[model samples]
Target: MGLRMASGKLRQSFRIYEWLDSHKISVTSIAESIAITPSMVSHTIRGRKNNRRVLKKLVDLGCPQEFLSLPIDLEKQVAA
Candidate 1:
């Protein structure tokens, strides 16, 4: 899983953003859920919500981790 993890940082960040963005979810709400500031998450993904805790929450919200962990354009998956 090293290869996957090695690529996880960017993938995870992007996946997190795409997931939340698509849902029309606000950064403040996401931040509240992850216990982090909206800026921290925003900074991570270029103004998109991107944090490990957020990803875990998204996963818990029914997003399959297998697909989430993959380094793909997550926008398509999470859009409406």
Candidate 2:
């Protein structure tokens, strides 16, 4: 068995995603920067792709790779 996330449920707990959303950064913006479509971002966010490529995107967005290891406190971040 593999790690399982709720299907089609956005893992919004990531601090970056949360912060962006908090600042009202549209999903299309994120998608544009990441070279993916808004719907693709929507799908990936919704946990439709449990692989969760957000980490890579974070790196592309200039977030330090070391921060990848930081505890995300998924529950709180997602609930925000």
Candidate 3:
């Protein structure tokens, strides 16, 4: 294992995906901007990817700070 997140589960809903969608920015476009794959971006939104580098990139791309305060609720979101 390279780096394991302290919390195996992500602990917040990073709204980056929503922002990108609302702004009509394609995942590929943002991925290119951040030098990460589109799927990595998708996984971040879904709370499946929790690498520090990716999290930092999301923040740089305008992910709100408030999202960091929201508790992780992947199962709840999935159920809804």
Computed on alpha carbons, the lDDT of every model, listed in order, comes to 0.55, 0.52, 0.56
Candidate 3 colliding pairs: none
Sort the predicted structures by lDDT, highest score first. 3, 1, 2
Residue 8 miss distance in model 2 (angstroms): 8.0
lDDT of 1 by residue, 1-80 (tens): 32333335444556655767788877687678878887874654442333556555566566556445533334334442
Q: Which wins on TM-score, candidate 1 or candidate 2?
A: 1
User: If ranked by TM-score, best first, what sequence of candidates would result?
Assistant: 3, 1, 2
- Residues 1-80 of candidate 3 have per-residue lDDT tens digits of 53333442544544555666777867687678778898886666666766445555555666664453223343233235
TM-score of each: 0.46, 0.44, 0.55
Evaluated at residue 31, the lDDT of candidate 1 is 75
The candidate scoring highest on TM-score is 3
Worst 10 residues of 1 by lDDT: 71-80
Name model 3 segments beyond 4 Å from true.
1-15, 68-80
Superior candidate under lDDT, 1 versus 2: 1
Q: If candidate 1 were superposed on the true structure by all CA atoms, what would the RMSD be?
A: 7.5
